[model samples]
Target: MVTLASMEPLLPDSSRELEDLAIELTSVASRFAARLHPIMRASVGDLVRSMNCYYSNLIEGHNTLPIDIDRAMAGDFAREPEKRNLQLEARAHIEVQQLIDRGEMPYPVLSLDGICWLHGEFCRRLPDDLLLVRNPDTGEEIIMVPGQLRTRHVKVGEHIAPEPEMIEPLLARFAEAYSFKMLSKLQKIVGVGASHHRLAWIHPFFDGNGRVSRLFSHALLRDLGIGSGLWSVSRGLARNVSDYKRLLSQADQPRRGDLDGRGNLTEAGLAEFTAFFLSCCLDQVTFMEELLKPEELLNRVEVWCNEEVQMQRLPKGSWPLLREAILTGEFARSQAQALTGYQERQARTVLSSLLDCGVLTSPSSKGKVRLGFPVDIIERWLPRLYPAVR
Candidate 1:
């Protein structure tokens, strides 16, 4: 039976390699923010939230296409029962994530209460079909109880979970080790990577453990201020699911030898997994940074706007206001006519056209217009961010 004490050296030592990774992560995060204005950042954050949900669901083997997710968000559900349940699951994931990003749930992310709440909240909103899990060998069915720890033994593949009574105590120790006060900023970032595997290793829940662990890590990154909601670690993990699962399983191995670490779990394996996890994070941040570079992003928008204008989907001179909004993040509602360089009536035509097409969005009719990255337009505005959907 694995216990908290058995997971020795919960984090790797501060070595040159770890330091380099920490520095690069910080640098990339700073650079990513510098690439976009605040309003654009918010817009990108919303896009990323949608993408995050897509990749997260993808990792769960539910290929609810990104277009389908958008449709579901707009109140459209699939006719097929399984696909519809998957859509609801994706929506639930995004909703929970929005709450986390807003800091609405205040529990310490690594704490037992936090994990339980995360699981309960996510599972509570899931569809009825998703609430049932079957044992592969015995065909035994289990009904999941939201917000409640398991009272029976469970095995996830070759790994057996700790005794049901041991769950709370192990989680308490987890909180103590990964708590904010206990780690430096860099260590905390590293902690996020480490705890991701450790939590999954714990397999605290019967059904939603993987999703809960991903969300838990996401909340940790969000709290660390590096997450920013502008990009996600899930995308990288899902893209590299084979290596991710392999690394996670390897990290579950027993200590290799006397030099590994002073715990029952292998420090070398944990360190290797952390390195891969952080690399995934760094890769995601770098991808978004390259994708959002002002010059490249503007060019894409310009090309799209030009095509739309030629096709009469938008009024003439609409590109100027759209470009201004994209470059400056947002533009005043009053300056619409001036920015479009057109008569009042003509400018309103452009603005209204853009708004109707979701090229622009505002809080209300009288509010400032902000750039919008609608899913249908993602192919042109932001390519390869998520799988292109029809």
Candidate 2:
């Protein structure tokens, strides 16, 4: 019964309110990215990707711990089958996101090929046990094909997906309607939210649609030069998951009356969801900005270092070198003695202790050291970024 027209109102009606939200998000994201040093930005970005992967999976009920995610990144796996599988899944999500963050994709994120790539990349790396989806109606287990459009009809809760034959045209229309080159900068930001809902409504793939949609949105924002990898909307979404789901479901409703735009779906609902999505993004950027404020962050790190020194866990002079790294983004190995006001031998010992504890890292044996957010210390360094590892 569905046709290409079924995916109507690819974008919400433009309003001053939506434009204001988009403009504010643009300004805040730019300021946040500009404030951080390049090296520090890269380090923070790596952590945000893991945080994003954690929450994106959490949205789907996969509760992989942040510690397990770090272990998985280091090529470690659990002995038990289920736990190990979840680790692999987490690893897969992070890897794919890294590729997107690095601008390695061959097609525009809103395009058909790009969406498929997102789904395929994430799904292919998943363990075989995790690729099977069982139908609630017939109790039949279906093996979802990675990067392939669905060949059979499907239903998600109260909404049924378009017929398999309609997917290609629908997706082509979806891509055209949300093309980055066609929309103005402000419109593109709004489209990120609008496309999110439309993609979910289409249900183009058999599984992983939610993740693919989110990754698609992430890439879209990055392409717009807004997603500096410094912050993630997934954290906000996961934190207020009830409202997130409610808005998404509301946006899927049919046009209520003449007051709504002339489309099969509700324009007011789409606009409402877009507002919610942008608000979540703005909230996260603001939260990260507050967390990374230079003075506050330095104080927090210094306090943790002093506590460690008092406990004899770290050498006494560790805070000075850490302060140098925090202020300068990175520091040369030879500068450590001067920074710490210690003799070369004593400074070397202090540096070694910090490295052993995973607070400082270098690319090679003698390269410049930069801040490292090892999972164990993430709570102390960046509290509430994730739940404490207890």
Candidate 3:
């Protein structure tokens, strides 16, 4: 088994104080990660924005850019040829749908022992040609063997790093940790972070390790307590990839021991890496949470989602029409009637149903409903849900 370096860093930075900041930062992050759920559905716009951030980061990290998700998901962008990265993203969305449909966790059941990892654990797994990551040096992408995806020296971003192993044992470790009988929020947050760092060291598969790691990271957070699973940890890691790698490398790099011929890790370095990772999570959560406050300009549609669900159910006819209006973010209730072609009362009735579902924006104090906060979120949440609505 590969082991992390001892508690002290191999090469100390000039400033000693920079590395010891974990206690203060970790405390804040741990708290935010625990509460990410309250803010997940804060807005449909937020949902799209958060996910857009993830997709963009993923593309950017690979030295490429993606057309907006809407275009790709809808097949609206007719020109750009299908790319490996986009296929990977499409598969990830399928995984999310699988979770929604299963209405439960599957990591518990997933294993990666064979050349093939989880088959459609998420709807469909990309073929090797599409899923394999490129080698930065040779500009080659590899996908021939299962183990090679992790251990094979391939390429990502600018340089070649070890492929991470999301092999059987790793998945088992995740499933076990997730089922952690004690399951406190703090334990989940910190435990997931530790798992994140630990997986990096394992360097599991030949291709898509980083991507898989983040997908699992988000999955863990959702299983723990996050509501929407919209926020992507990869966004944070990609934001400062250099610092992220630097800290992790430092943590794994061992110090030359005095005459022992064995290397030891600087505990402080590991702590620093964990701290930075935690801080990234907290920062994202804090930024997202702010969107939910009454004062900030939250996505209106999201505001509707967060309200009480206990309102009496809307009558059947009313719900279909109303849900479309709110779900589509169409302000003119009348237009809802046009889209669904429901009769006047029928349309209004369904709209009323939406209100009762706690899925409507509360009219302002003046008793008039305006499009609730980030109206944009509907664009994402609605579209994302359509396929799974069945």
Q: Against the unseen true structure, what C-alpha lDDT does each candidate score? A: 0.85, 0.90, 0.46
Q: Can you write out model 2's per-residue Cα lDDT over 8-62, one digit (the tens) per residue?
A: 8888999998999999999999999999998889889899999999999899999
lDDT of 1 by residue, 119-220 (tens): 988999899889998888788998888878887788777778788888888888888898848678889888888899989887888888888988898898
Which portions of model 3 show Cα errors greater than 4 Å?
A: 1-56, 59-67, 82-104, 109-129, 132-141, 144-188, 226-230, 255-265, 298-390
Model 3, span 150-240: residue lDDT tens = 5555433333343344244444554555456775455455555555655555456554455555555565555555432444455567676
Of 2 and 3, the candidate ahead on TM-score is 2
Count of backbone collisions within predicted model 1:
0
Winner by lDDT between candidate 2 and candidate 1: 2
TM-score of each: 0.96, 0.98, 0.56
Query: Which portions of model 1 show Cα errors greater than 4 Å?
Result: 180-182
| TM-score of candidate 1 on Cα atoms, chains taken together | 0.96
Residue 87, candidate 3: C-alpha displacement in angstroms: 6.5
Could you tally the backbone clashes for each prediction?
0, 0, 35
Point to the candidate with the largest lDDT: 2
Model 2 deviation from the true structure expressed as Cα RMSD, one decimal place: 1.2
Error of 3 at 378 (Å): 10
